[model samples]
Target: MNEALWALGRGTGVVALLLLTVSVVLGIVTRSGRPLLGLPRFSVTLVHRNSSLLASVFLVIHIVSLFFDSYAQLRVVDFFVPFLGAAKPFWLGLGTLALDLMLAIIVTSLLRRWIGRRVFRVVHWFTYALWPVALAHSIGNGSDGTSVWFLALALASVVLVAVAVAWRVSANFIEFGNARKGETR
Candidate 1:
C-alpha cells in the first residue's frame, strides 16, 4: 500500500511534468501561427487550459501521496501555510504562492464574461508571476531537481515561458507606441 502510494506520487509528478511541457510547447508554437499535426488553434488553447487543470490535479495527488510515502517527509501545513515547510521553507512557500495565484487566475477566468474584460485581463497578469514561482518551487523542493532529466525539463519550461512573455510584452509595447504615434499625428 505504501509502495502503491509512492508510485502514484511519482506517476503524478511525471504526468504533471509532461502536461507542463505540452502546454509550454503549445504556447510557444502557437505564438506565431497555427500548429502542425492537425492541431486546431482552439485546440492549442484547450490544451493549455486542460493541461493546467491536470497539473493542478496531479499536484494535489503528489502532495497527498507524500503523506503516505515514508521517503518524502511532507506535512499538510507545508502546503497552505507558506514558509513552514521543513525541507525547504523558502522554496515551498513559493510553490504555495504559485498555487494561490493560479487559483486567482482560474477564478477570474471563469468569471471573465461577468467580470468584464478589463478586470479579467488585469487579474490574468498574475499568471505571469505564477509560472516562475512554480519553477522556483520545483527547483527548490524537488528531490530530483538537480538531476539531468528534471533540470532539462525545468529549463525548457522556464525558457519557453520567458520567450512567450517577452513576445507578448514587446507586442504590447509596439501597439502602445503606435497608438501614441497616431495620437501625436
Candidate 2:
C-alpha cells in the first residue's frame, strides 16, 4: 500500500543517515591510521568500507520506495535532476545533489586502483559535502523532521562528526609539529 511504501522510504532514509554517520566517523578514524574502540586499524578500515556500502544500499531502498509512493509523486527525472520536484523542490533538490555526489564518490572508489590515489581522494572529498546535504534534506523535507526523536538523532550525528573532525585536525597539527621539531633537531 501507499502507507507501507511511505513507511519503508522514511525508515530506510533514517537508517541510511545513521549508517552514513558511522561511515564518516570510521573514515576519519581510518585516515588517522589509528584503531577505534580497541579495534585494529585494518578492522576500522573494513568497517568503514562496509558501512558505506550498507548506507548506499539503504539509500537505494529509500529512493525506490519514495519513487513508488504516490504521495511523493516522484518522476524518473527527479532522480537525476535537482530542484525539479513539485513539492519542496529545494529540500528535495538537496537530496538529489547528495545522490549525485554519492554516485561520483562510489564510482571513483570502485575504480581507485585504476584511477590512482590522487584522483580517488579528490572525488572522495565529495563525501564531506554529501553528508550535510543529505542531513539537510532529511530535516527539511522529512515528515518527521520536526519530531523530537528525529531532532535528537540529527543532533547526535552532528556531534559525532564534529568530534571526529576535531580529533583529525588536532592529530594532524600534532604530527606537523612533531615533524617540525625533528627537522629543527
Candidate 3:
C-alpha cells in the first residue's frame, strides 16, 4: 500500500517533468514560426497548450501522493512555502518555487486576453526559467534520480529543450540579419 503510493508519486512526478519538457519545447518551436516535427502551426500550438495542462494535472497528483505518503512526511505548508521541509530542504524548496512559478504562469495564461498580449508574452517567458528550476529539483530530489530510465528521460529533455532554444535563437538571428540587410538597402 505505502509502496504503491510511493511508486505512484514517483511515476507521476516523472510524467509531469516529461510533459512539461514537451510543453516548453513546443512553445519555443511554435514561437519560432518554423515548421516543427512536420506538424502544422495549429497542431503545434494545440499540443503545447494541452501538454501544459496535462503536466499541471500530473504535478498535482505527484504532490498529493507525496503529501499523503507516510514516508515523504510532506505537509501542505511545505508544498507552497519553500525551504521549510525537514527532508531535502534545498531541493524540495526548489520544487516548491518551481510550482509557484508555474502557478503564476498558469493564472496569467488563463487571463491572457484580459491582461493583453504584451503582458502575456512577458509572463510566458518564465517557462524557460521554470524548466531549469524544475529540472534541478527533479535531479536533486528524485529517489530514482540516478536510475538509467530517469537519466535517459532527463538527458532527452535537456537535449530537446536545448535544441528548441537554439533553433529559436538562430531563427531570431537570421531575421535580424535579414532586417539589417534590408536597412542597408
In candidate 2, stretches whose alpha carbon ends up further than 4 angstroms from where it belongs are 172-185
lDDT of each: 0.71, 0.92, 0.90
lDDT, candidate 3, 4-117, per-residue tens: 889999999999999999999999888877777698978999999999999999999999999889999999889889989889999999999999989989999999989999
- In terms of TM-score, how similar is model 3 to the real structure? 0.92
Indicate whether candidate 2 or candidate 3 has the larger lDDT: 2
Clashing pairs in 3: none
Instruction: Provide the global lDDT of candidate 3 against the true structure.
Output: 0.90
TM-scores, one per candidate: 0.75, 0.94, 0.92
Q: How are the candidates ranked when ordered by lDDT, highest leading?
A: 2, 3, 1
lDDT string for model 1 (43-154, tens) is 8778877887888788778778977787766677766777877767788799778767767887898999899999987886676577677777777777676889988988
Q: What total of clashing residue pairs does each candidate reach?
A: 0, 0, 0
Q: Which stretches of candidate 1 lie over 4 Å from their true place?
A: 21-40, 170-185
Q: Is candidate 1 or 2 superior in lDDT?
A: 2
The best candidate by lDDT is 2
RMSD of each: 3.8, 1.9, 2.0
